[model samples]
Target: MTYRVKDMPACKGCPFYQTGEQGFVPDEINTGAKLAIIAQNPGELEELDGRPLIGRSGQMVIASLGTYGIKREDASWLNVLKCRWQNENILPREENILRGAVDHCTGAYLRQNLARIRPNLYVPMGDLALHWLTGRENIGHWRGSVFIADSGPIRGSKVLPTIHPAAIFRQPAWRSASKSDFSRIARELPKREPVVTYSDVFHLGVSAEEFINTIAALKGPVVLDIETKSTRPKSERKPIEETLAVIGIGWGKDVAANYVCDAALDEVLRAIESADVDWIAGGAFDFTVLTHYGVKFKWERCHDLILLHSRFDIELPHSIEFIASMWTDRAYWKHLTDTDLLLYNALDCAAEWEAWYRLAAFCKARAPLVWKVYMEDRPLIEVQVALHLAGMPTERGRIQAEKRWYEKERETAEKALLAAFGSTQGSATAVPVCATHKRYTGKSPLKARKGEAEVCSTCAAVRRSYIDSQPLNLRSRPQMIRKLRESGIRVPLTREGKTSLAKGVVSKLLKKYNDPRLAQLLNYWSKSTAVSRYFKEAWISPATGRIHSVYSMHSAKHRWSCQKPNMQQTKRPEKVLESLGDIVETAE
Candidate 1:
C-alpha cells in the first residue's frame, strides 16, 4: 500500500519537506502478529521501493532472525517517519528541519501506527526508535535491555532495542553486539514479560545504632556497594580523591540496607571483614577506593561479579544496568534522578545481588569449568588492590620537566608546520596531483612529492598547488584516494567499498610504493597526536604518589589488559623510572 501526502494531511504544509511522494514508504504489516519492528525512517532504496524493511538494513534483520528460528513473515515492520528526511544529495537535512519532521511525523503517524498494530513485543532498531519508545538515547548502553512501557502508544508492550544494521558500516565492532540483541529478542518472545520484583525492604537513613545492628546481624553472603562524593573542583589537586558517602548492603532476596558513612564506620568495617562472602560488581574500583581512604576489609570474603561474568560471557556488557536488565526486571535507573543517592545505591546493591546469584547459577549449570576457574582467579582481586595502593613513586620535579618538554616539542612542531604550509589566508596559484585546488590551513605539514626539494617557505600553498586544482581536504578518504591515484598508486577499498586508509592499508601502501612523501605524511600526522597524548592520560595518582594502572584479565584471548594509562603500551621516561622505587609485582 502506498502512503500519499494526502494521507498525512497535517504534513502537507510542513516547511521541513522539500520532496513529495518519493519520501513516503508504507509499512508492511502482518496483522495480529505478536512482534513488530520499528526503524527511524526510510533509506534511499527503502523510499524508492515504496515499502519499509526491503533495503540492506531489513535484509540484515531478516538474516539475524533466520539464525534464531524466526521467519521474516513472523513480524510486522514499520518506521517512525513514512517519508525520507535526507535531501537530494542524500545528506541529512538541517537539524531543525530533521527535528521538526520527527516531531510532526511521530505525533501524526508513528504513535497511531503502533496503536493500530498493537503488537505484544516491539523491537525498536537504533537510537531514534529507542528515544521514541523510552525517551532515552545511546543504543550502546540500552541494547539488549528489556523495557516495558505502561503509558504510551507502546504501553503494555515489551520493547527490546538493538543497533541498526547500518551501524555496522561505521562501527564494525557493533556487528556482533547487534546479533546478540536479536538472539535476546528471540529468547524473550516465548517467555512471559520479565517481572522485576526488586526488594521493597529498603532501610534508608538509619541511626548509627541501627546501622551497626543491621551489619552485625547479617548472615550468609551479602552484596556490597558504595556511593562516593565526587571531589570535582578539588579533584584537580587530588586526582584519586573519593569520600565514602553511603554503603548499600543486601543480604536477603527481598531486603536492602543503606547506612550513612558516619559514627559507626569502624564497627561496620569489622563486621563486613568477618561476614560471609560479599558479592560486588566492579569490586576492583570499590576495593581500591576504600583502601585509599584507609578502610581495610577481607578480600577473600568478596566475589567480583565483573570477573565472573566476563569469564563466561565476555562479549556482553557486565555493567549493573546491563546485568540487571538481563537477569532481573530492574528498570534502567541510571537516567533517573540521583537526588536520592542512598535509594539509588540501595537499588544497585539489590540488582547486583540478584544478578550475581543468577549468573553464578548459570555458570555452574552450563559451564562448571568456568565457575571453577573464577573461584581460582578470585584471589587475584586482593593482589590487584594491593598494587593499586602501592603506586609507582615518581620524582615530582622530573615529572614536571617531562610535561614541559612535550609542551615545548608541540610548540616547535606547530611553528615548523606553519612555516611549511602557507596560512589559510590566500588563493592557491596552482593545483597539485590531489586534483582539488583548496585553501591551505597552516595547521599541518603537506609533504612535497619525491625530488621536489622539501620547500621551507612561509607559504605552504606553493606545495598545496601541486596537490589539487580545487581545494581538497587531505584527511578525506576520497581526496586521499584521488591523490594516491594521481601519483600512480592504486588505493585499496574497504569491504564496504569505501577507500581503505586504515593503518594497515597505509602501511602496506608505504611498503609497496616506498614513497618518501608517504613516509613523511605518516610521521607528520602522528607526531602532534603523540605529543598531545601526554596531557590526556592519567599520569599520576596523588593518593599513591605513583602510577597505579588498572590491570584486567578479561579479553577475547583472556590476555591481561591494563588501562587508566595502559602501562603495557607505554614506557616510563628513563629519568622518571630511575627516580622511582622498586616495583611491587603481584603473583599471577
Candidate 2:
C-alpha cells in the first residue's frame, strides 16, 4: 500500500515480503548486502515494473562490476528516481522531480533500503541520483569522500561518486580510465564494516588536458643560416668571371659528402664539412657554385635562414654589415682586407643557425600544439605551433579552419602572381652600350647598344630600367643579355634570365618548378627580399615525398634563425636524380 506525504496508510492486502522475516515494518532493513548502486532513474522497463537500475543502466553497471571482481547478485541496487519518467509519463511540472529529490520520505525510502540491505558501499551514478540518495544540497562537492548519512539505515559509510556509465557509453575513450575509477570502489570494500570515509579512496582524478601540452613542445633537429653581398650599390651589378667558393656540409641528419674537396683544400673543407652532425648555413650558394666548378656534392637536408628570420623571432638589422658584425662577432665593414668574403660570411651563418636552435627550443617548451593560421608562406612552423597551442587550449575545430585558410591564402598569392606576370618572360628590343666606348662594344649594356654618347645611347632603355630596378639581384647586364640571346627564356637554365628566354625557355626559380606557389613568389623577389641572386634547385626530402623547409623562429628578431645554402637564398628544386634525397634515406 502507498501513503501520502501528509498522511500514511498501513500495508493492507499486500503481503509482507520480508517484513515478517526481518520482524519490522517498511522502515527496518536487512544487514547482509555489502554494495549499493544508486543510479539516476528508472529508464522505461524498470519504471513500468517498479525496479531499480535493472534496464540499460543496470546492465552496464553489472558489466562494470564484473570487471571489478563484483557480480550483479552480490549487490542490492536502488534508484534515485523510483519511478521512470517515460515519454508520456514525464510530469508536466519539474516540481515532481524536485519533490522526489527534496522530500524527506524519498530519502527515508533510501534509508530504509540501505537499512534492510545494510550495504556498506553506496555508488551514485549521476548528479540527480546522488542528490536523491544523499539529501545534501551540494551533492557533487561531497561526492568523492564518504559522507555520514543524517538519515539512513547504513549511515556513516563510504560513497564512490563516479561518472554514470551512460556517459561512458557516449564517450568510449573514457571506458579504460573509468574502469580504473571503478576498481577503486572495490578496493574500499575491505574496510567496509568500519565505514571508510570518502577522502580515504578519492585522491587526484585524471583529465584530458595534460596529454597535448607535451606534444606541442617539439622542435626540429637542425639549424640553418645564410650570408650575402648586400653592400654594393644597386647599379654596380655585373656578372663577370669570378670564383664562388663551395663549402660542402651535411645538414639535419648529417650524411658525408659524395665528392670531397681537393686534397689541398681538404683539411679546411673537411673541418667545415665534417658530416659528424647536421650543419646548416644559408642557401647552398657555395654548393651550387662548387657544382658549377665540377663539384657535384649531394646534399639531403638544409634549413633556409631567410625563412627563419621571416618566420621566427630574429633581430632584423637594417644593413648586412651590421648583421654580419653582430652574428659573426667580426666586423664586416673592412672588406678591403685580405680576408675572404665567403669564408667570413660562413661565421655569421653559423651564428644564425644557433639562434634558430635556441628559439625553436623556447617555443617547444612553452607553447601550445594546436593552431589557427590565416596566412603563411611555405609553412611557418613556429607560428603554426604557437597558434595551434593557443587554440588547442580552447577550441580544436577552429584550429583546423585556420590551417585551411593558410592553404587557401598561399594558393591565392600564387594565382595572383601568375595573373600579373603571365608564364612568358619579357624581352627588350635592343641592347645598351657603355658610356666610355663611343661605339657599341656589347660590353656594358647599361650604357647603350649603339649611338652618340650622352656617354652613349643605343640601350634598350625600358628593359634596362626594369633590370636596374632589380638591383638587389646583381646580374651583369651585358653578359646576361648575351646569355639570354643564346638560351632563350625556357632552356634547362641560363646564367642570365635573358639567356633562358633567348633559348625559348623561361628560367624561373628552381623551387618553383615543383611548387607553383614558390615560383610565383620568387618572381616577386625584388619586392620580397633584399637579394641579387636567385636559388638554383631545391634541397629535396625523400622521407615523405613532401618538401620540408628548415627554419628558425627568431632570426629576424634575435630569438630564432635559419639559413639557405650558398648565400642569401633558400634551396631550389633539384634538377638531377637523387641529388637531394633524405639525409638518412632508405630503400623502403
Evaluated with lDDT, which candidate comes out highest? 1
User: Largest TM-score belongs to which candidate?
Assistant: 1
Model 1: how far is 327 from its true place, Å? 3.9
- Candidate 2 Cα errors over 4 Å, as ranges: 1-30, 48-50, 86-97, 100-108, 134-155, 193-588
Residues 1-588 of candidate 2 have per-residue lDDT tens digits of: 322212222222112111211111122222465777776545555533445555676687778778877876677776543432211223224665456333543454555565566566777777666655654443323333344455433347666666677776565644543564466667666666424211111111112122112112323333322222333342331111123332322222211121212334433433333333343444333333333334323243333444433343223322333322222222222242236443333334343444445434543565322111101332343342232122112122332233233345445654575454442334433444435433433323342111223433433454454444342221233443433344432234455423333212333434334544334444543223322222221222232232222223434333433333122342222342243243213321
TM-score of each: 0.76, 0.30
Q: Would you list the C-alpha lDDT of every candidate in the order shown?
A: 0.67, 0.39
Please give the distance, in angstroms, between residue 329's alpha carbon in candidate 2 and its true position after superposition. 56
Q: Stretches of candidate 1 above 4 Å error? A: 1-11, 29-31, 63-74, 87-93, 148-158, 168-199, 218-220, 233-239, 252-254, 411-530, 539-544, 567-588
Worst 10 residues of 2 by lDDT: 197-206
